[model samples]
Target: MARTGTRSTIGRTPPELWPSGGTLVSTDLLDDGSVDAIAVPLVPAVEGEHGAQPGEGAADVSALYGIDLAEIADRVGLTGASGESYVLQLPRAVGSAVQLPWQALPPRVVLLGLGARSAADLRHAGAALARASRGLGRVLTTAGVQGSQSASQAAQAARAFAEGYLLAAYRPPTSATGPAPAPSAELVLLGRDGTRVTAALDAARTAAAATWLVRDLTTTPSSTKTPAWLADQAKRLAARRGLETQVLTPRELSAQGFGGILAVGAGSASTPRLVVVRYTPTNASGRHVVLVGKGITFDTGGISIKPRESMVTMKTDMAGAAVALATVLAAADSGLAHAVTAVLPLAENHFGASSYRPGDVLRVYGGTTVEVANTDAEGRLVLADALAWADATLEPDVLVDVATLTGAAAVGLGKQRGALFGTDDALVAALERAGEAVGEPLWRLPLVEDYADAVRSDVADLRHVPADAGLGAGAITAALFLREFVGSRRWAHLDIAGPARATSDRHEITEGATGFGARLLLQYLADLR
Candidate 1:
């Protein structure tokens, strides 16, 4: 239950299904006219006006159809309303004797609707167009997010379009490819030539690169994503990005008293590891932000095994770690002024002879004991160890832990949003703003101090989860359980269980790992003082 009602699977999957933002934003298309489509965004008509305003490059595209866009929209009964799309097919340019190379197959001219020109609407429009252009060689979009706007405004629109396009034009690397919305080799956003707009789009592409990496890592099959594999990926990232990294082995974990992590991973032969990555820029902001991501490689609910259906998507349990690692690397890529450290406690919860059982008490990092009430609640257990370790060692100004910790989050918020909880209001608001800007919206739920007693253990300092299945507010109690690890720090918890993975394609989200936190955290870090 991380980022959605459930989590997922990956590894051995070829990444050929989607482009990884590598040379995705181009100034021009192929010289041989590989572009199969041109998407021009449309703005709705004014209250009293007759037709909608056409996006840039519309005149050039409409000429190919021998009619203006307004007439085409009217002819097709296409209203430029939000989420509306119309593809005006050019069937061999209506039997033209002399056909241009681009008009050889009557290519496509798509009109995408932008509602109120909001960032999200713009992103959705881009996503819709991308989906419509699936399986094509190339697509050039005049996103209609430019002109008559300030530099920042123009940059915002460009960023949104790029993010949306890069994100939505993806399909899982699966063998059975039956109408899963194949991605184009390249998607060029036209009319983004200014310096400010170029840099903004560049940054957004960088962020998308990070998220793509996250999705790839989380999408791998569990057998290929063991704790060692996760640590190796982290090391590879550190080596490539010049970040400081350390991978702690199981022996070291036990010596350092990471009881929770050790216990949760005991049943798995892959062992457990804690990967610490540090990014210290030269002119740092002097404010440290320590991130702790739950790295459960595959969750089988330990002794409390899940139903056969529930186990299907459990491999995405490590999505939080993938996002945390990706975000830190993106921050380093952007050269942010702040110092960021990410602690990913990697494990796999399996049911075996050594599986930590209910009624078992184990000491987590920083020497706090927890009662294992529910083995399925291993996410918070692993996160607690990392949070405690970060608070005791990193001295971060702001502490944030990310996890797909509970299904209750999806139960309350659905699959559209993530659950945000924190001890500091300002931190929460900043995060809210960042999430909103990145199109990964968050819904803040109160800490509910009264729920503190629900996680209280009769035997240990805390219980991993309430013993009663009927106990409501599972998300709140789960957050409360995590609150005990950070000591008086300005901390925030991102329970991405509601939106970490998607059940189907929606907006810019595909039917797999959503990689929700990477962009949001990157945005927040960019705005930090």
Candidate 2:
């Protein structure tokens, strides 16, 4: 069943909510018209007031509650407020249902963990709350967060909170069904210093919503999210956002001589397309950042069939496309400093008589030829053409291509970290830093020159798959294939096969596609600007 909830906004509350050090203010007990919950500042003065006698040091919440930590979790979530001194760690975050009992309180007690919580941890916790309260119609009427007096830092936290909630709760309605569910509540900042923070958060929320809009379209099943249909979506978003847009059909690609994309998509009845979206800010003077996404809406392994289990999540093969489109939207909404360009190479890999076979050499966009060793390795083929086109035509300051390209990435990093490989160290460093700031973990993998030799074809310029069947390095080989097209352009390749889909049960996601790189790319672009 679909989960539902709401966040109510009804009262004017004090902004002095974040307590530095550790302090507590007790509310009037059981008053006739008292508020549902009160925000207590964890300041230093209250630490002594809570009871710290000489020779008898105070205890933490676990000891003060006089119960096991697990039991407390069972009762009221993870909020710890039993007259104990919690070492306030900057940006730390934790939650407890005890802070607000869902059944007893007017609304559930949603505690905001600030001290020990990293930005990513807070985002993770916020997403969890969205799921836990799904369909319950719970609202975040009050938020208790702590930080220094810096307005930007506070604003950063507020923006993070908003992005977390917005992305975690978004669900696109299935085409067979009707519209998506309505939002449950209004998000309001809890403290006084939130005026500027609120505005920053509002900007971030707008960007996140745009991300959801694009991701939903990308994640739709291939039966529905066809190349032409995806182009329609790009056109709609462009018209709405006032960005420049163009859609090239299979015939156009063939005429333009983009044989790699055309050849891979020839077997499918859906055909193929290349979507381009451009956003130029009014006062921007910086060079453009081009985002290329591999939009294989579905992959059936072409002439080479995949196992049933491997084919189940093929709908999300376009996750990179989702991020590409979402990044452009985010850049425009945030008024980023640089001009942005997004290129989505959309196609399908299916089996039919027309399907390209093994040993067939494909001449991609930049005149590079590739030997099709495995038709299932079609993502690289499409991206090779797209990347070549981007380099030769757009000639942006930097080129970034994101794709759910290889299973080897999943085997290496699991689902929490995305693997990044590139030719430019500075560009890679910027992405790494951006990933950390947003709580989206990214790791750099080697693109050894030795690996490139493995993909070299005896008959053509390159082979779709390496010569050795059992040898891994699939991610490296995919990146190597893409490198040929990038040429000398500053480029980075993100293999999101690991993080594109959640691997296990998490606080925010319960299976299905995760909006993995939307925030990372958004923040990275904003920073570059």
Candidate 3:
């Protein structure tokens, strides 16, 4: 069929021509650069074993075939493909003694043990394989044991893993320094008969990669990716994916009475923008999903300016927008048979004479007036208008808003786990399940309706933040503020303050944008039906 075993993988270079760490590919063997066939041994390592040794049944086949072979006979397991020169898997993590030949198998293969098979681990493994594949300039593929008890779960894992790996490996043309290199391709899930794990993995991976395309555009620098710029990005994506994109500028927003967005963007040079992206498949069924995201390009805290120390990183305030766009893209890529809409209210919070005062009471899109208690608390204001719009426009079956809304959320959930607040138990459960499936951790928290009274204003419909409320509940109060705008829609809020940006790690990725919800949202949509 599709070239079974490691021997068939000798010279494929869909992603790269060579592997990283100075490994040579079989494609570079001729005097003037020609391809040739090379033989490598395939050995399986079982648990509690040291190296491969010729087994009893293998003696007859070996004698009949007369194949040159080497043995590491220890019980390290391999998921797929048996061939000459294949780098076999050892059940446990063990160091390699010799330089691995690139052409022996795919350019890169990650042997993820059974213990570390979570979606996040798979993502990390994918990232590792992508780096190796990109360096080698060859196509990268992964093979692993089908461990899940459920066939669908196993298939989902394989596909999700392939998608994450391929997307992580992508290097955009804009990010390239000199004469750009070719893009790398991805493959995964080998050898599971009647299993269609490959098909599922391919579909999921395609969807995940598409989400990354949108996320990358949103997570880029503020100088290059302003509100208008991001709207353009959404427009381009919608067009490419056969979706609908609507961009509203400052004038249109003001005409439509989106006072919250107008107020937040008044102080910045860049005008506020509201981008609504919609995806509707031909035979859409089931519940409609709505996503709202905060799009603050940079948060200077208005008149309540932030400290000069590390304020530069505030550009990532729009991380919520990135997640929103990525989620929509993921749905489209996964071919989810549902109606999805992503609404992003984009702005830059800064200090200027035209900025709204602390006592300003502005009417939102839904005629709800909010007193601006603290200008630093600006993300909720912008999101308030968009959330109102999402509810009024779609009246969706379920609405979920994602934001890097509060530092308190970061403190509450750390950099990896996100806090989920919602009125809908079913939607929350689905999101949590999707998070687990994709390795993006999400935890549920109480809305504590009592806190709603805390945000009530003496004059306006509500106060943007509760002055009486302690700083302990900043994240909760923020979610509560947006809750007022959600109306009767089944809604959830995800605060991803900590995980959106990163510091550093030992991985090939240094630290800038984490590219979070793209994969998670993709898988969520895929599993919806």
Candidate 4:
């Protein structure tokens, strides 16, 4: 329950659930006393060059003050290595010369390295500067503004920089240790012609705000985030963006025969819910995409419980649902022409007397029966019900589902990228391109038709888990099990077990749930035909 029309950041501060009221951005010229700090990019010296070279902002500084920044770089041993930074005191750097620009200047100037000037390198550079600017209120930066690149390339680079900055600024709400450092009040990106990259800047900010919301939702403790609670949040999300929301109660789910979802939630104190969010454009004339996410607020592995240490971070098991919810909201916020709908199956897999045992046969939507081999492999069960329901009822042209479904995904792909399994090559290529552009890379893992027999059950249509005594491809087997429900629809599956939560902060990822699929999915939908 939030008041309407607050006007903060992307679109209204969006209730207290989202801590970042979003940050205000501007493309105005530098004004003294208006900013806390300024970041100037320094291109490192090439093979035989003399010293570090100044980027757009540094060049402007040299022109305005009549000084040699290169000389200072040489004296200070500043090499423009990627992620390298040199701090310069504003008034002190100018020496005793006349400070002709204004009475007061920014307190500090950060000279950051732009190695190779590639998008990936610049994105890292932006994150580094943002992390360093922790205490500052307002900061101006030119980390990605290279004068030698084309207008389009410059705009792309600027977009990456702004996105990285906003993403790195996110800090989850905490109470154990006093107050956490607040995100910067405002961020200013310097454009070449004062307003040239304004649209790109705004788009980047909106997308980043969506990512922040996902992070907030995923990191919340399960003590507060239940299936019914997530349904309530759906209403809040629908209200913030002009969209439609619907919730299916336990009774409705039972009547509809969503056995997979109901079976997983039988052990938990809270009931299950299926939340649907839909977005239709003003002039709807594009391909329809249906998105499904696995929302397990807390996973205790049902009857087969996990180790105590393994359950510590289980609160973030709902990250995939967070990604889907945020991406659909972002599509509406950006006003994408394509019609998009998100189906989230919400439940908590707790261990209790009522939990489904290892040999129970549960029927999913569309009357597809599955044998429960191990209760821990519950993600695919819920996703199966949603995927079947969406394909049968939603009339979607394409289907995509995201989930933190398997530890084997992290074992195979490490912690950097997600595992992508899809039937359509063109759709897979589009998703890969979108992921590459957003720094959320995806590695394609085969659906391996030969391995399909491993999931077949002797007592049911399929077994949710593979044989424990023989085969090993857990991630692939899980995807193949989910594929059975798609029923010829062009679909893609994202197994984000590794990248969904970060073990340690790196790149633009925080220590909690990474909010992995939000940015990549939004980018894909934005560019969809």
**Which is the better candidate, 2 or 4, if ranked by TM-score?**
4
Please give, for residues 15-107, the per-residue lDDT of candidate 3 as tens digits: 321221111221222123122211121223457754443321234223422332332222343331221123333132236655433323332
Off by over 4 Å in 1: 1-34, 49-53, 93-106, 174-182, 467-469
Estimate candidate 3's RMSD in Å. Answer: 9.4
Q: Which regions of candidate 2 deviate over 4 angstroms?
A: 1-107, 111-115, 132-144, 176-182, 192-195, 503-505
Worst 10 residues of 2 by lDDT: 5-14
Candidate 1 accuracy as TM-score: 0.89
Compare candidates 3 and 4 on lDDT and give the better one. Answer: 4
Top model number, TM-score = 4
Candidate 4 lDDT over residue span 124-177, tens digit each: 777777777766777776667655777778777777777777777777765444
Q: Write the per-residue lDDT of candidate 2 for residues 115-224, one digit (tens) a residue.
A: 23446554554554454334443233222354343777667666665566566666654433455454423343444244676576666676566556545665566776
Candidate ranking (TM-score, best to worst)? 4, 1, 2, 3
